[model samples]
Target: MAAQGQAAAGSASESGGSPAASAAAAAAAAFPATSLYVGDLHESVQDAQLFDVFSQVGGVVSVRVCRDINSRKSLGYAYVNYNNTSDAARALELLNFTPINGKPIRIMYSNRDPSSRKSGAGNIFIKNLDKSIDNKALYDTFCAFGNILSCKIATDPSGESRGYGFVQFEMDESAQSAIDKLNGMLINDKKVYVGPFVRKQDRENVSNNIKFSNVYVKNLSDTVTDDELKEMFGKYGTITSAVVMRDSDGNSRCFGFVNFENADAAAQAVQELNGKIFNDKELYVGRAQKKSEREMELKEKFEKNIQEVAEKFQNTNLYLKNLDDNIDDEKLREIFAEYGNITSCKVMRDSYGVSRGSGFVSFKSAEDANRALTEMNGKMVGSKPLYVALAQRKDDRKAKLQVNIFLHGSWIYTTCAFMLFHNSECLVFACMVGEKSGEFY
Candidate 1:
C-alpha cells in the first residue's frame, strides 16, 4: 500500500506536476488496495485460521495476526491480503461479521492513509441508543442510507452498549440523510440524538464558550464572612448568594462560591476579581465546574506535562539488555563513559541482589546517547551480545510496539513466531543437558 503511494507520487513529480498534485496522487493511490482489516477476532485466532476463512472467497496472498511484541498475545485483529480487489470485495460482503472461534469479526477495506478518516467527511454520532443495540443491528439500520464504511456501538469493557455509537458512510449525503430522518426519532422506545460527529478537541472548544451564572472563588482570608464576600463582589454584579465554606466548627476553609443574578454579571465578576488582592490574599475566580469536568481538565494538564517531560529527555536515555552478571553501576557507566558524560547508570537487581541482566544508562545529551547506542548495540559484552535501544516510558513503548506490529504485519508475525519456536527448542535442549549433568538432582 505504501509502495503504491510512493510510486504514484514519484510518477506525478516526474511528469512536472505541482507538489499539491503529487500529494493528491499519492493519497488517491493509497485507497485502492486488495487488503482488508479484520477486527474483533477471538484471542486464539491465528494467521492460518484467518487464511482458512478468507481463502474460501479467493486467492489469499498473505494473512497476519498482529500480536504484542513482549507478551506474544493476539491484539484481537488480523489483516488479510488477496490477489485481486474483486475477491477482496466478495470476502468483505460475505465474511464480514462471520463467527470465528465463537466471536464475530468485523471486516473493512484497509485504509493506510489517515487523512481521509480523520477528515470526518461522512461520519455521524448517535447518542441515547438502546442498551440492546449491538454493532450488527447498528450496521443493518444504517446500511440502507448508503454504503457504511464503519458502524459501531460504543461498548464498555464488559461488552454492554454505552448508549452511543458512530456510523461513517462513504458519502456525506448519506450521513446527512440519516441525521435528518433519524434525529430525535424513536429507536427501541428511546429518543436518539443523531448529529454530525465533532472531534473531541472541537467539542471542548465549543464547551468553553458556554455561559455560566455561578463563580468559584478560593484563597479567602480566615476571618472573611459571607456578608464580606458579597460586599466585595457586589461592585461587579448583583449577588444572589455568597458563602465562605467552613468546617464543622464554622472556621473558614479558605474557599467559597458566589452566585450572580445573570451570566454576564458572573462573567464580569470573574474577569475583574481573578488575580485581584482581597483581604491581603490573591483570589482565584472562575466559572464553577462539576467534579467530572475539573478532573478531566486536570487529567489533560497532567498528560501535557508528561509529554513535555518525555520530549525533554527524548533519545538521552538508553535501555540495555543481556548485561553481563559482573556489570554493576560503575562498570556500566565506564562502558559508555567514552561516548558522553553519564548522568546516571544502574543495573537492575532482584530482591536477592542478583543482576537481572538488564540496566539503564542516561547521558547528559541525546547526541552522546545516540553515539553509545549506535556503537554498543549488539556488541559482545560477555557471554551474550548486548541489546540496546532508547529507553521509553511504559505507555510510549506499548504504543510504538502496537504501531510496529500493525505496519510491519506479516514480517513481524513471522519473525516473532519463529523466535518463539526457536526459544522453546533451546529450552528443551537445556533441560536435557541439565538432566544428564544431574543438575536437577
Candidate 2:
C-alpha cells in the first residue's frame, strides 16, 4: 500500500471549487464504465456516502459497497472503481487515512494483475524429526533448499527439539522450491511439512510420515528366515540390512525389513507388495509411518465417520414403540422411574409434537438406552408391539449428525443383556452377542 503523492492543485475555497459544481462533477463520474475500487467503509455507511467522499478526490467509475448475501449485513469493506490510474492515484493519496464517520479508511492501488499474488505459503514445517534434531540440524536440512535467511526451531525449557522446527529460506521462491520437493517427504520415518511460519504445534503432526515405505507381513511360512528374506530382496538392490523381529520364542518375528541400496528399488518393492498376495499371506507394504501417527489418523477418521453416520439418525431422540395406547409420558415415567433420570419425553403428535401412533421414551445413560432398546426391542405392551432401536424423526434423519454413534455403545452387549435379564426369570435362554448370559422367556 505504499504510494508517492503530489500536492493538490488549489484551495477548496477557490471560486472554481464551488460546492455545487464539485457535487455535480462527483455525481457525473460515479458511473464511469470502469476503474474504481473503494475500500474500508463502515457497515452502516451507504453507497452514496462513499461516492461523495471518494469523488472529491477524483472522477469515479463505480462504487460498490459489499454486503453479506444472505443476512444483507454490511461486510465493512467496499470497492470503488475509478476510470483510470490518474484518478485512482489521486484518490489513494487524498483518502488513504481520512476518517469517515469516525472510522479510518484504508485506500490502496487495486491490483491490476491479482494472479501475481501467492495462492498459499509453501510447506516447510519440519515434522517427524527426532526430538534430538536440534536447530543446527534443521538449518542443515533446509540450507541446501536455498539461501535460508532465518530458520527457527521451537524448543522446550531443556532446549530439546520439540520434534518439529521451521526454516525460512531467506526468500519466498526458495521456500516454494522446498515446498514442492520436500513436502510429504520422509525424514527419519516422518514427512517434512511446510507452510507459513505460524506458531501452532498441532499442524506439525499432519501426515508427517504418511508416504508409505515399510511392509507388514504375517503368516510367514516357518521356513522363511531373515537370510532368505534378504536373498529374496537382494535382487532389488545392494541390501541396506534385513532384520527379522523375533518374539520371546526366538522364532522369525514373522516380519523383516529390507533397506534398498537406492530409494527407487525400495519404492518399487513397496508398490509391488502392498496388498499383493505372497506366501499365502496378503503382503501389506507402503511408506512405513510411525505407530502413533497411524493411531492418531485412524482415531480421527473413526470419530469423523462415526459422527457422520450417527447424524443420519439423530442420536439424541429415542423412540418407544408398542406402548400401551392408554400409556402417556407420565404413566411410562412411573414404570421406568427406577432406571435413571429422563431428559424429556412426549408422545409425538402430527403438528402438536403429539404421539403419532407410538410414542418415544428417552434415558440419559447408555444403560438407559440399552434398557430401552432391550426392554422395548421386542416387548409386547398394551395392544401394540413396542419396537425400539433408535428413533430418529424423518426430518432429523436428513440433517447433519450431531451425536457420535461409534462412541455411543462401547459395551452394547452388556447394556442390552441387562434389560433382557431384568424382564423375566424364566431363563428361556435367548442368546445375543453382547449379552453374557442368555435371556429366559
Candidate 3:
C-alpha cells in the first residue's frame, strides 16, 4: 500500500481491494497516517522551512526537525503533520526527491513504530554530498525522478553535515530511475554516490561492503603511484579508485587497493595478476582481509601445520635414552632392528660432533616400535639401563618433565624434584625429607 507513485494518489480508489486494505491498515495504526517522514534535510533547515515547503501541497498543522537535547542542533530529519491523510499523501508525492536550497530531500509516510515499518526497503542512500548543500537545493535536484516520500541528511550532535542522507520514494521504478540517472553525478564539485537503502546490520554482512568490485594487491613497486596503480588495473574494466598505501613521508608501502565498477573486472585482475612478477617481486593480489581476519587465518594455518607434522610421525617413532656416547646411527639401528625393520635411526649429537647419549629410531610399523619399547625399556645396555618410550615432539617432551606421582597410604612424605638436562635425556632425582604427607608433586 505504501508503494505508490504520482499515479497512486488519484488511483487509490481502484476496483481491487488495495484501497480497502490501505484504509484498514491506516485505521489500525497507532498514529494517524496524516504524518510524513521528511529526511535528507540540511542541518541549517528550520521548522519554518519545513512548514513552508510542505504547506505547498497541504495545510501543514506542524513541522518538527528532530534535534539534540543538549546542543539543540538539527538531527537532519523532520516530521510533518497535516489535518487530512489525503493532504499528507499529496505532499509526499510532490515534494519527495525534490531539491530544497540546492540539496535533495526525501519524503515518506511516518511509521513511528519501527517494528511495523519496512525500514529502508523503499529508501535510497546517497553519500559524498557537499557540506554546503542545503535541503532545498537537494530536493530540487531529485524531485523530477519520482514521488519522494522523505529526504534527509544526517548530522553530528553539533549539527554539522555528515555528508550523507536518505531519500524514500513511493514506487520502486521511481527509485531505480533516480539511482540510474543521478548516481555518480557531480554535485557541488563532488561526485555523489547513490544506491538502494538497507539497514546497517545488513550492510555489514554483505561480502562487498567496502565495494562491490574491489581487489587488494601488495608487493607493489615502491615507485608506484595512485595513478599508476589505477592505470595498471584499468585494463580489465573501468576503474573507480586505486590507492597505494603510503607513509607520512609519502614513500609508498608497496601495497595498494583497487576498486572497479564491475565484479567480473576485479575477479579478472585477481586471476591475472596474482603471483605475476612485477618490479622483481611476485605480486600478492586477492580479496582484501581485515586485520582481525588476517591474524586468525595465520593462527589457524600454524596450528594445522603442527597437527600435520604430529600425525606424520605418529606411532612409528621411538624415543631412546641412557645410550652410551659410542652409539652411532648404524649401531642404534642394528639393535632396534631385532624386532622389525628399522626405517631410520639417529643419535643426537653435541657441538663437538659426539653423540649426546640419546637418539630416536623409526620402525616400519607401530607394532615393531611398541615391541622394541616394551622389551628394551629399563633394560641393561652397554653401561646403563635404557629408557624407551614413544618419541614426543619438542612441546610434548617439556610437558612430561613435570610429573606428579601419587603415594597412597604412606604417612611419611618426601619432596622429590627431578632435574631434566638440556638434551631431555638425563633425569637426576633429588629428595628433601619432610614430616607430613599431602597431595604433592
Off by over 4 Å in 1: 1-31, 224-282, 288-441
* Candidate 3 regions with alpha-carbon error over 4 angstroms: 1-212, 275-282, 319-335, 341-367, 374-388, 393-441
Superposition TM-score, candidate 2 onto the true structure = 0.35
The Cα error of candidate 1 at residue 242, in Å, is 8.0
Candidate 1 lDDT over 176-212, as tens digits, reads 9777767877777778898999988788888877899
Q: For every model shown, what is its TM-score relative to the native structure?
A: 0.52, 0.35, 0.34
Task: State which candidate has the highest TM-score.
Answer: 1
Q: Which ten residues in a row have the lowest lDDT in candidate 1?
A: 431-440
- Model 2 CA deviation exceeding 4 Å by range: 1-46, 66-78, 93-108, 112-114, 118-232, 250-256, 279-282, 289-441
How do the residues 1-441 of candidate 2 rate in per-residue lDDT, one tens digit apiece? 110110111122144643323322332344222344444455567888998988887778778788879856667677788766557645654565467865556543343543322232332566666665655445445544444333456654223456777664434676776665566666555555655654344446553323333444444565677887778667766776776667678876455566666767777777666676657766545544454444445445544554444333234345666566577778776765665666666665557655566665556654455445655577666676767755532433332323221222212221111111111111122223231011111
Q: Candidate 3 residues 335-413, lDDT tens each? A: 8879888877879998989888888888776657766887899988889999998774444452222222333343233
lDDT per model, in order?
Answer: 0.71, 0.52, 0.68
Which lDDT value does model 2 have at 108? 36
Quick one: ranking by lDDT, best first?
1, 3, 2
